[model samples]
Target: MSNIVALVVIRVALDRDDQQLRRWERKIAFGYRMFIGLYALAGASTLPVAWLIARASFVSYVQSHLLYPLVLLAVVEGCVEWGLSRLRRGRHTLLIVTGVLLASIAIYFNPRLHAIESILLLPILASVFFLSPKKVWLAGILAMLAECILYWLNPFHGHESGTTPYDLITFIVELVGETVVCHGIIARGAEIWEELRKRGRLETELLVRQIVSEKDAKTDALTGLYNRKSFNEYLEFALRISAETDTPLHLAVIDIDNFKQVNDRHGHLVGDDILRRTARAIEYHLAAGDFLARYGGEEFALIIPEMSHEEAVAHVEKIREKIANIHHAELTTQHATVSIGLCTYVPGEDSQALFQRADQCLYQAKKSGKNRTIAHP
Candidate 1:
């Protein structure tokens, strides 16, 4: 009982403040249904015990013991049907009331049953599930009152001719103590659920914030491309793995043609737009194993791995031509073109040597004419 009630309380409390409470209410309903089932099963057990007792004639025992259980089972089932209907409609309190009623019936109907006083606690536990002090107190008092009434009406039910004042006091203490524990379990369950929930939310928020912070550190804010520092680290790692595994590598550096003249004639915003547009254009043509980064103010670096020499040159030419075709109305008529320098990596070549060769090709491309590519063998 404690385990079921505690689970229900914890789940409902944790999910209540979130939008998921509606879904978890079914768990609460399930807990109540379990209580109802236990009550019914306990009541039904009396039938077999009554049948086995040979003290009375079969007809007499059937009249005294068997008949009442049959009637009680019918009534309990009726109450369960009514309660469950209300439960389906989200009236959870109906099940709690039904459990209390059924448990009471189980105890009173089986008068010759031993230790009947212990059964009084079932209703109190059900009432305390609400986590309301007043509800538990009211339930405890009413239950004690009802039990006293039953004992008074049937004095032979106790161990002696009647219950003594000491027995009465002992029952009160036990009832109060057990009721307190039931209340505490539910209240404590809610507190534990709340603490765990708060910690989970804080952790999720910190994770997201950390992810965003790391991205800002590694990427260009304007172009949303990997910045120079990230590109350097990526290239260094790519080179080490390529040399170890004998994978081919090609690196290129692209500089926008007449970028300074464009910035001088237009403005920084247009320059920024051109840079972003060029990044997007390069991204569209890149293969799965390609890496592109904004290496400087007007320069972008690209690394393509596991491609043949011919495929690399053809791809770089395609990107260069795509950049040369970008038309801007704000530029008044002149189109922006990019000059690229391409080189394949030697088997054991360091990053610096490979970059130097690509940079030299960039120098050659500019020396020959502005808008073109220079490939270094």
Candidate 2:
């Protein structure tokens, strides 16, 4: 019985583990979809503005290199959105990397378009939304560095044009504003994401623990089978189903014959071992629709759905033979045997009446001599 209870506990643990893994997978997929949609929308909104700026800018090199790359990034972002819609994990990362690379190359070639640093906001948000906090911070740092490098280069011939003090102050203020806003947003998003991840993990752990606790509560400590409480619950549910379907049900009460003698001869420990082994042997012969529960010390109850009295009796006989064949040498005992009492379900009968009839048969089995089965017609 202890072995059976252990098996039930293991099964519940495995099921809970599987459920948690699925929950995490779903959260990741949801986050990925949100990233793709937001990026695609941001890219679409920024593409026309990028083109207009490029047309108005004085640097021919900036218009050709920077504007073209921005448009290409918009296209890649759109493709990533479509890939996410199709449930593809691979295409999303690929497009994000490709877009970032193209944007970096454009900035490196045409430092004059440093005014377009506003575009960095998209990458900063995307990195934080989809990647870890560390990666998001790294992306933000890289954007800041790129802007500073472009500011120093002053590639639009602004340095040669002898930039005034007012222009320099305005440029510095814009740079600081852009960096502060983008960094703040990305950092805040990262904080929120981390909190959510922590909560989700905690919830999963709590749910698994609760399931295990409930399973343990329903299980018998000694025999590893369903205890009386759990058995009663199962019996009630089975009886209800049988009544609804108009199917026959069979109940059997089994007692270990001469169990007290075994305990007296071999000590209580050995006797316990014998009880566990006997329960296993009986379980091995049971059909899938049948269930057995430890009813108390040295006694077990079996419920077989859709089984008639004759069939149940025959099955009990087989179990008696199997028990007789079981070697009790490990327990330092001579022989181990079980006596069974069988009763078939009657329509509109309660559990008490059913149990009483089976118990009466058990008394008859013991009176006729132990180690045999008695059936109630």
Scored by lDDT, the top model is 1
- Name every residue pair that clashes in candidate 1: none
* Per-residue error (Å), model 2, residue 259: 0.2
TM-score, structure 1 vs. true: 0.68
Worst 10 residues of 1 by lDDT: 18-27
What tens-digit string does per-residue lDDT give for candidate 1 at 22-127?
Answer: 3333454555456556645754575577557764675666654546654664576566566655554533355445545555555565566667667677667766
Task: Please give the RMSD to the true structure for each candidate, in Å.
Answer: 7.7, 7.5
Model 2 lDDT tens row, 270-351: 9889988998999899987888999998999999888777887898899889988998775554678888899988889988
Number of residue pairs clashing in candidate 2, backbone atoms closer than 3 angstroms, sequence gap of 3 or more or interchain = 5
Score each candidate by Cα lDDT: 0.75, 0.69
TM-score each candidate. 0.68, 0.67
Question: How does residue 17 of candidate 1 score in lDDT?
Answer: 57
What TM-score does candidate 2 reach? 0.67
